[model samples]
Target: MFELIEPIATVSFSKVVTEAFLALGMRNYWDGYFAGRAAPLGLAPAEVVHAVFYNFADGEVARHVPWVWGKTTPEEAIAVRERSSATVLRRGIGVLAEAPGLVRVADLAARAAVSAPTEGRALYAALRTLDVPAEPVARLWHAATLLREHRGDGHNAALLAHGIGGTEAHVLMALTLGMRAEKFDRLHHLPTARLAAVVDGLRDRGFVDAVGGFTDAGRQTRERIDALTDELAAPAYDELSADELDELIAGLELIAAARYKRSDD
Candidate 1:
């Protein structure tokens, strides 16, 4: 049976983490850190709850501040805190107001005897079909659920990459730039044969010409993928409090920063 509490808990915890990061302009760091660590910690209901507070307190402090890398000083960190706090306040208001609707959607899904994937897809389609304002958030939740449910051997990441384009590198780049590398890595840890099959699927689709190469068709495919993701995420923005939005933006920045840092290493 589908557990309504699990999804709600996961979504709420995720939102909290995202909001906390935004307050410090450390969204990317949080996203990347969680992306890498979420599965390793185990995606259990209790684990999800524990992760929120733990990561919010420890992860942000350790990963987000550039001072750890000597890019900023103590005084600069204070200034960032002031600015990020204001942003967080605004985003929090938005997300709190919109959260009830999201919960309602989850409740509806729980009543169905569907699998999480099916429930998520149905929820996503229903959100769009019904013109719900939280459609974008719904889609993101759906994607997250799919990612979480299949977090081994890079299966989820490869599938998402294939859906976007054939080039695993490009997909990795996009996800790392937009999400987190740890998360990307978790989804792509497949054996050699499975990896080859994933690559072959992309080649067949003309989404990629090689492992790291992009075909003209692949570029077009990527464009479509971006469009769809954007379209799906548009509705959820309305529900985010100013704090949540800032956190999400910050998370994106952190992911970008982490990606660059990795490249530098």
Candidate 2:
């Protein structure tokens, strides 16, 4: 059931899809990710990106904004990622794309995505303005991307309400999920001193132990944040009937389970 949206939706940002950005002379990791996500916003400034994106370190946001635009127009970046993501999804989903349920799922997903209010949801609002593809496979992925960014925006709001800073949020995730802190640091360009400071702050607040595992209080806090995020994201699905949601989840699971290697990979 959890695979309904994000698991399929996030393929838009996957490395396989981002590789298309490299053809534009963009770097692989940060450049592709930030540019593809922000391109829909049309030459958005770093401040807007920093404000809307949340969570990532400011340095991480700064690394690509403004400059990526000079290398490639937002429309080109958008087209590249969309085409790339669709190719991966189409190849992976194979016969499932032709299944009768697939079109229904895409329609159901789009209904839910557009039904949600856009106020205070920057990423969702921006992405929603784009033309949805006519093809079912592309439409399904587009619907998923809309819902994913919409939920992510709500998740950010949930974190803000709890007074959780960006670095602190990532810190709690690593501790609670049993992920290595070093791994999180490797993905994000957070400064070593900043990471140490965030950990220190969490320790001071009794959120983590000296060795960085979550204390009971920290675990409870994360549970609360997760619960709030789910609550906030629930509105996006309001247009779907309970039965429709079940069908959507089932349909998405079938698509996500499909296997195919990306040619670029």
Candidate 3:
């Protein structure tokens, strides 16, 4: 699912999504990212977006949210995300975008998505309230987005259960992904002192070493969080039969391959 949806979901680098927001008077990366994701929340306050988004720093979300709403209505923003995502996805997959099998994959994924419960999944629920796209390719992208946000909501729950804050989570991910912590701080626009403080807190918890890599305990804890997130996300896939699951994965592979080819080109 990540392979198939990432190209469309990553509005930060998407030509269509970014260009659409530029025309709408949004000039920064966050303007499109925050507005596109929060469109379903409908003129929601920055704090609400910060809470549901979980990973982005509060100030990052605050800089562009309801403010983006001021420049373009939520309906218009949602239309842009949906329309542009569908457009780009179809172009990426070429002729396969029109195959009858594409419709079946969308149908299977949508069934699983809409079947997922809304309790504790705020972002997914908001998207659920909107009409599902009628176009087959658009509907596939929409279903994938619904499922992605659904899992993200669960991921946040897993982190909170283990007492991990958002910044700390990113620090852990930075180590896990072999990325530099300083780079993460810059990307999140985190203050140096604040990031240092978060790293100190993790060190106190024995999750990270002073040298900026995960301690054995830290690795174990991160592993547990990852497992729990998947466990929480498992129920969302319960609606798919074994055969249907196989069918969907195979169908998505074709589209995913095309997207990779398109990206390469």
Candidate 4:
């Protein structure tokens, strides 16, 4: 029988350097390292490693790696953790306190087939218990109800605008272009009557002023709604075809129209 021998595996200095660079999110350095070693390493074109490096570099994985390693002060980390935990706890408590009162009001409104006085009283009591200021809490509760009824529909945009002191048109344009009303109007061709109607509706709802200014509450509402729309749209945007994006825009227009109709009623 022929003698059989196994070859020992050898690692390249380039490989070590490349790994170190990758750890630092410097993917641009991979090509130079991989160029000559591709065949020996059983890697496809040297470019393959470069592509892999870019993929990791562009992704959150490489961006979030803790390079400072053990450099953070314990006190600083503790403070950050405490702040984050407190915020979460506060939000949880607020949700728990407010949600039951809202449910109770809805239940009473359904069972009594009458005014929401009992529900309002319960909500007031709950807000007091939670140490929430009365007026702001009431507005938030009302906005939450409107959001629940209108989410995923055009009415949600209208309701959000109403909450903020803006018209449905302003909200719709903001959602489409990620900009304010004047900017959106400058970029697109909207009829004056339609624009005026949307502005009027927003003003009536106390979401905006005639001069297209937002009140503090309106600004907060707009920011929240804008954030929600961005979150909802971001994941699906890359997968959507041009036609699909157009369809979505069309749907938004329909929703705007529906909001206008609601205001008319």
TM-score, one value per model: 0.30, 0.92, 0.95, 0.23
What lDDT tens digits, residue by residue, belong to model 3 across residues 1-265? Answer: 5555455455324877788888889987669877888989987899999999887755877878778887898898898888887877888888888889889988988888788989999999999999998889888888888888888899999999999988889998988888768776544567778888888999999998879788999999999999998888778778998888888888888888877887799
List, residue by residue over 168-237, the lDDT tens digit for candidate 2.
Answer: 8888777766885657754345667877787888889998888878889989999999999889889988
Rank order (by lDDT, best first): 3, 2, 1, 4
Which candidate comes out best when scored by TM-score?
Answer: 3
Model 4 poorest ten-residue lDDT run: 1-10
Ranking by TM-score: 3, 2, 1, 4
Residue 148 in model 2: lDDT: 88
For model 2, what is the error of residue 178's alpha carbon versus the real structure, in angstroms, after optimal superposition?
Answer: 0.9
Cα lDDT tens digits, model 4, 1-265, are 0000000001122244344434434343333233222212222332433332221212222222232212333233322222332333233234433444434432322222121122212222221222211332232232222222122222244334444322353454454454655456432344666556666676677766667666555566666765664443233234445665455345333333443454476
Q: Could you tell which candidate, 1 or 3, scores higher by lDDT?
A: 3
Q: Model-by-model lDDT, in order?
A: 0.37, 0.81, 0.83, 0.35
Which prediction has more favorable TM-score, 2 or 4? 2
lDDT of 4: 0.35
Candidate 4 regions exceeding 4 Å error are 1-188, 230-265
Write model 1 residue lDDT over 11-82, tens digit each, in one string. Answer: 423444445434444445444233323322223233332332221222233343332223333334323332
